[model samples]
Target chain A: MAGEVKFGILSCANIARTLISAMKLLPEVKIHAIASRSLDKVQSFAAANDVPKETKLYGSYEELLDDDEVDALYVPLPTGLHVEWVLKAAAKKKHILIEKPPAHTVKELDVMLEALQKNGLQYMDGTMWMHHPRTHKMEAVLHDSSTIGRICEVHSTFNYSAEVAYRRKGGLSADVRGNPNLDGLGALGDIGWYCVRGILWAYDYEMPKSVTAHPGASYNEKGVIVSCGATFVWEDGRTATFTTSFNTGHVMKLLVVGVNGSLENDDFVLPARADRAGFKVVSNTSWKDVLGGWNRTEDVQEVTLEIPQEAHMVREFARLVASIRDGSGAVEPRWAEISRKTQVLLDAVKESIENGLKTIDV
Target chain B: MAGEVKFGILSCANIARTLISAMKLLPEVKIHAIASRSLDKVQSFAAANDVPKETKLYGSYEELLDDDEVDALYVPLPTGLHVEWVLKAAAKKKHILIEKPPAHTVKELDVMLEALQKNGLQYMDGTMWMHHPRTHKMEAVLHDSSTIGRICEVHSTFNYSAEVAYRRKGGLSADVRGNPNLDGLGALGDIGWYCVRGILWAYDYEMPKSVTAHPGASYNEKGVIVSCGATFVWEDGRTATFTTSFNTGHVMKLLVVGVNGSLENDDFVLPARADRAGFKVVSNTSWKDVLGGWNRTEDVQEVTLEIPQEAHMVREFARLVASIRDGSGAVEPRWAEISRKTQVLLDAVKESIENGLKTIDV
Candidate 1:
């Protein structure tokens, strides 16, 4: 129980490299093994990433899951494969740190969550920004009534252009994210997940009454969403909107406006800097006497991190896993709940987009 | 024609004070007269604002229009009065500098523009931000394909909390902007004008194909909109969204994302400082090799102004008037065209909100 938590990664995804790097920075966590369907890819990935010598390599995922040394699993597989591998990992009694857009739908996520819950496993999504100290600092300001008051509106966007590469690879049909057989949700699942999660996080995970996908959603030849936007309306008249795309320049922005103030961050999904991050907060904003200018300027509040946000995620996930393994604590339901809420909203947005952009009740 | 262009005030509204102050700063412009429906109000406003001793005082707007020495009129009256006064001013052959939300509808604006065109008078709106040097600099970035590339998306918001004051004044019924018989359009016309104009300006005045008002638009008891949002879709897949309110804290933000880059300005409507304004631009954005951070940081580009934006606006207006009166130029139609386009979109958003949040074709 006092030893480090062992993590076995289930794929050779580009994102897995980031997780492995983060694990290397945490003293309480260790990358115990890695696997891919092809032995050559696993060996090359391990070598390229400088995986520890003691870490085992498996050509098949089943072999890694059978290794009792791996107390927890980091599943960075395609969203379409999450349900299959996550259920298998849960049956092996492994705590999970899964990639986002956790599954193709909330139903799939729920089935996987039930298995983990029954096995008493710690479960958390791979939204690293949520683990950043800057996030918690911003939350403190949002929670303080005098600082931001009641949130009235929110807008978030996460976009990056992937069209150039997709075209070079003989169009979107060859892209993993654009292939319905591999990642069916396309841009909505791969990137829009961050925007939806950001809106839910800003609202403290309260589900919206209705979700309406903005019109003109772009789709690939295979009918996978390439770009989309949606609006969320709550029962109390509060509202939020988000946009995600694989056809625009990289942009990650989150703006939350309250009755008394507002807060904004340009890098809500990933910090532009690794050691420190900041957000702008302006409270009690008022005009200079004759409206020539604002009475107060936006204040930039920065939080310094000893390590990167992904490292923080690894440390937090390991701490939870350690507690559960030592019988010192029960499984934390908050993480799964957050992931479920995000997936539910993502599903609602997809439904609205598919149903002629109709308003879908959550 | 060699003398300074003389200006007459059409109302003693609060905003006229700022215009008067701006006129005082420009050597080519002179405040020749002040007028209001009430003599006492006009006299008090002139005294309070330190009007020149030679400036004439009129008890009625009709008298100000009849003044032979006044070359132009600055109309800052309520939105409902624009069509009437603007047409009257045009008939008198006076150059006009009108406040924004040019008219209640595009049809009314067209009628006013027609009158102005027939009279051969220069027509310009009082959107001071457009005249700022910073605006031109940002435009340069937008026009350069390498900097921001083809504009893909835009999000603008201009909100100010007037709820506390409105509640104190008998629940919005007694408020000027909330009064259906006066401003009529409420927050949408009053503050949303800036957001609509901002979006139009960012898109270089291209009209969108359709507009859909987001749900949960709040309205007063008299059916005046207090808060609202809308999404705009262009034929080429470029899109924009905007939100305006009298129920949230002060916020003026314009974010434009392009295929290769993005630009954002927090104080787009009114700069945070009078002497300087700035915007953040980031081009060719990409993640670092291992996704630890961004490869480049957003650059803050600032432009210093020799005078306030309002002063620059007055100076520009006077220049155009001087050119027209001297037989050196004709009325510039660009200003009127921009105003008309913004009004058309604003009308569409209002229509969408009124008709059950339907998507209205532009």
Candidate 2:
């Protein structure tokens, strides 16, 4: 069941570039094929990467998933098209590691996953920051009673400029970043999802009973927020906040506050090279020594979670496949779980965007 | 008129400790007398800190202001009491340096200043941080044509535990810090005012044409805000935002973004002895330096903002008196200007707070 995972990337959106490069570093994986809306793009990508034999090219995603040899699919389409492709691929029995956010609405997200369950396919959202081992290290500090001493409060902001090259009119009059119908939440949905998802995931998805989202200072009052924030009132009385802006230059960081001290990491995601990212864990105690006891700080034992980038996607897909092959796994895919908890707040964000920061009764 | 300015200590509040300590270092100041609700309190302070030749201990502020020799009075009373005492002292023909948020209501603030003008007394609300010469130095970078560029946006936040403590029953009882009536806008009025005032001041009183604040988020939502944020829009399509929280832990910082570059100072008002407070100005050249020849890296110079402890207050008060004595000097105090602006927005804030973040028609 596991000599190596055969992975096939769908399309050549720039986001897949990092994961495709990451796959090259791992021997247990093979980038067997790629499909784009255009055959020329897929074939060119296959040749440019020196993809191994059996690196077939398909003109359409439907044609690609129909092949019995194709084990899984990665969906990184424009935000609007994601649900269509995800449901279609899931119906074909191909597992998925879809790009964020998998769908725009919670109900739409649910329908996509239910179809997946009806056909039995694996799914994972392209939330890569959590895959980094540092995320868990931060969580351990929060959960570890001995360290960080009773997590008092936490705050994080993931603000990046998505409109640097963004234009209302593209080669075909398409805007993957600007159009709200295509891109759910501008600043909030794109990268802000990470902050929302990160805090929610770190806190074990203790779903907030109520949430208030605000586009108080949004651009043009397009309510297509250049900056929007929300407060999540969790069941356990823990609170987390999310702040993001599509207009601001770039500053994506996370902070975990505790009574004893805090764990602050600005470089939330590690780059493929690892060295370029000063992805450090600034804590009061030596985290490396604490997580990796004596003699374990050596290079091999340093706990660098260099997992397959799409490999998490690939593996999550494979795990879904293996689970369906065995009749069980998580109740729903991690992607679905994440989408459900965050999407309502996201929808409330949509409502907040439209209705001006309302409280969503979750 | 040509000599050092004589001063009177009008109260024995803990907040006044710093300014009182600073008076010892400057020979250009004369501590004329002291007054308090309790004669014992003023007597104890006079003995402990060295009140000049034959200190006058008044049982009431009335007797203290009645003394003809006292040129200026320093009031560090509860936030709510500023208007009352300021009115009384101003009527007695004494220069007024009242504590921050000169009054809870804009109406009261207007009347308090009217009395000052009526009596020909200089007036300013005590905002010790503004007095710090470094604050002016930082402002210089924003104003300086050479270093920082055109100001586009600003993000500021000032929060700590003082909010929650104040909302409890009798929290401010006799303690000014905990009383909402005395505090005016609670967290927003207390700290957010600084960021708002700083930006507006830097922009030549760009009265935000409109403002939209978020619905209050608080554990105890009935009182003032535990956390609140607002977006201030000016007439010329410029914008700024400020957030203040009594619920969150300590962080008093400001970040100003400009067209070509940005400057950030986190510890703007830390005690004068605090390490590394001086502003760090970064230019388009900073990017160049990071790439190897970064823009002229102007290291954070150790700026001795002539306002140490309360020397800014003492010196400023002295300057106001000298102006009165010589028939010429800096007549209008910085506090009066800042207070007028504060009252304007604070008046707007009440509507902003009540109307679920709508901009008041100021």
- The numbered model that scores best in lDDT is 1
Q: How well is each residue in A116-137 modelled by candidate 2, as lDDT tens digits?
A: 7777666677787666555556
Q: Pick out the ten consecutive residues of candidate 2 chain B with the lowest summed lDDT.
A: B286-295
10 residues in a row with least lDDT, candidate 2 chain A: A290-299
Q: Residue-wise lDDT of candidate 2 within B238-299, one digit each (tens)?
A: 56666666544344556665544456665453531422246656553321100111123434
Candidate 1 lDDT over residue span B150-218, tens digit each: 998998888887765456676566777887777888888888888889888999999999999888789
Cα lDDT tens digits for candidate 1, A157-199:
9988877546767655687798887789999988899888889
**Candidate 1 share of real interface contacts:** 0.63
Q: Cα deviation in Å at residue A51, candidate 2? A: 5.3
Q: After superposing the true interface residues, what Cα RMSD does each candidate give?
A: 1.6, 11.1
